[model samples]
Target: MNKLMILTGEPLTRSILANFFDGISDFCVEGSFEDVPGLLSAVQNSQVDVLFADAEYAMQGNFLPLINPYGAKRPLIVLLARDGQAAAKSYEMQNVIDYVIKPSTPERLFLSLQKIRMQLSLINSYEAVGAPHSPRRDYVFIKVNKKMVKLSLDEILYVESVKDYIKIVTEKKSFLVYNTLTNFTASLPEGRFARIHRSYTVSVDKIDAIEGNTVEIMTTRLPFSRKYIAENQLKVFK
Candidate 1:
């Protein structure tokens, strides 16, 4: 089970988030704070997996400074904000998986949570073993529903996770494979594809810009985490 810790100043918002997860399975609300007053303590006690915080609260007040300093592995952050579009560029948080706009439904929040769990799984899956695939050209085969199809690597702009499945997004089309990013990546040539973030992987040829931790690929902004950046750097237009 993933331990969830929430940091929000709004009591009503905090209660809503806490109550929502209580009804869900495999997750327990470890702690919900009015501020970052006991952030480290809660993390110490429960070993929080993901953090849901309010951007508006953090910006004005001295809430917890985004990342968990004492943690061996920093908890993944999911920023909750009203103006997510505006906050996207503002936050640019490497640890933050995604930003959920305010008044978001459980469906939307769970979708992001699924991606987060898959992401953590992917990283752990690859950490111990070497990937068997080498950079291949021409065509690649991917799982689509119960059928298998060949997709040209050049046509693919990026890939994102949706629940237990992965979405292969191409220039003109998109397809979902009932697979994890760890498995879905086996179809791609490592030399050409970059794991921009946990929930995202993009073709290097498709990247438009790299500003701080964010990568703009084909009109979409994706993030790369701090851990990966130190070892591998992606090619960016500017």
Candidate 2:
């Protein structure tokens, strides 16, 4: 289980977060603080894997200056703010994983927890192997219905983004995954996929034709955004 800490200046907010995490099996709340010094001290004394902090306090206060001195020992941060105003600035910190808006719900927090798990998994894998693991096989494991589903890379034709989810299209059917287009694309083999639009990513080798702004895969033609024209170096565009 990953140890988590909550650092917000409001006692009510801290209590709510701590109580919400009580039932979660994968994470344990080490402590919750209404001040930076208390949080910093706890961080120094405990083994914390994740820290959910108020975004304003993290950015505008003396919190970062004191905490950053810990360097590699600093726990991963998830900033909580009323709006996205502090998101860009807070993300500059390497340890920050997610920035959530206030009045956080279980669903939103679940997504943030998923990101934290993925980051921790990557870090652990790299530390154990001394390098990033490259895919040796053509298949990748995707989470579906609370289980891991092994999917072949070649089985993917294209991916469509729908709001907070992505649809992975294959020959027979498509799977709806609770993931952003950006995160889903990063999980796939890098060179094999081309992001042709903000909402669409296609398999490079599966391209049947490209006429104007449309890319044809099998009998289906998908529109490509001109914004990616310069970024696309596929000879098919020639």
Candidate 3:
């Protein structure tokens, strides 16, 4: 299980976050502190995979120097901010992966943790299969407008099935092709894409958050079937 820590100046906020994280299956709340010194000490002594910190402490604590970005021991930070300015400022730190505005709800926290879990799982998968000499497979070509167009795998956000056609969505544009979802997905690299639903295949790294049957990618929420959830539970979340 991933070790998690909560650092908030408010007593109520610290208690609430600690209690909320208590029920999470993937993480163990190793420490909850209201001060910078105690939190820093705990992090130095123990192995923490994730840290949740309030913007107030994050800004005042000068925490960046203590963390090494290149080290394997670095903890992923989830910032909790009361305002946009502080949140934006906190984002300058290299380890801050996500930020949640104050008055956090159980649902919001769960969604954030779910997304983090997916990311950590993806990282582990890549590390397991990574090799020094492996050739990079970064892009693929597909026929679009009667011409073969190069599509970078990183550019693809998700794939949607529309009857006899499939739509490939990216950050900027989308492409419609005369192909089945399975056929199109097979062309992509393995482990990078997942068949979330019968009509949807999502880029694992592109997923923003997951709540119930819906997976959020950018601003869009795509429904996923329980079949994928059940079968990939161990493989994805383990």
CA lDDT for candidate 3: 0.75
Which residue pairs come into collision in candidate 2?
A: none
Clashing pairs in 3: none
lDDT of 3 by residue, 113-199 (tens): 886787578556655675454466677655565444668899999999987668899999998865567666766677788888999
Ranked by lDDT, top first:
2, 3, 1
Models 1 onward score TM values of: 0.48, 0.51, 0.51
Clashes of each: 0, 0, 0
Least accurate stretch of 10 residues (summed lDDT) in model 1?
Answer: 64-73
Task: Give lDDT tens digits, candidate 2, residues 20-73.
Answer: 889889889998888787987887777778889998776663565355442342
lDDT of each: 0.67, 0.76, 0.75
Best by lDDT: 2
RMSD of each: 12.4, 10.4, 18.2
- lDDT of the structure predicted as candidate 2: 0.76
Q: List the residue pairs that clash in candidate 1.
A: none
lDDT of 1 by residue, 65-130 (tens): 323432113466678888867556435333556778877788887898786787567545643343
* Candidate 2 off by > 4 Å: 68-70, 131-238
Instruction: Compute the lDDT of residue 18 as modeled in candidate 1.
Output: 88
Tell me which of candidates 2 and 3 scores higher on lDDT.
Answer: 2
Residue 47 accuracy (lDDT) in model 1: 62
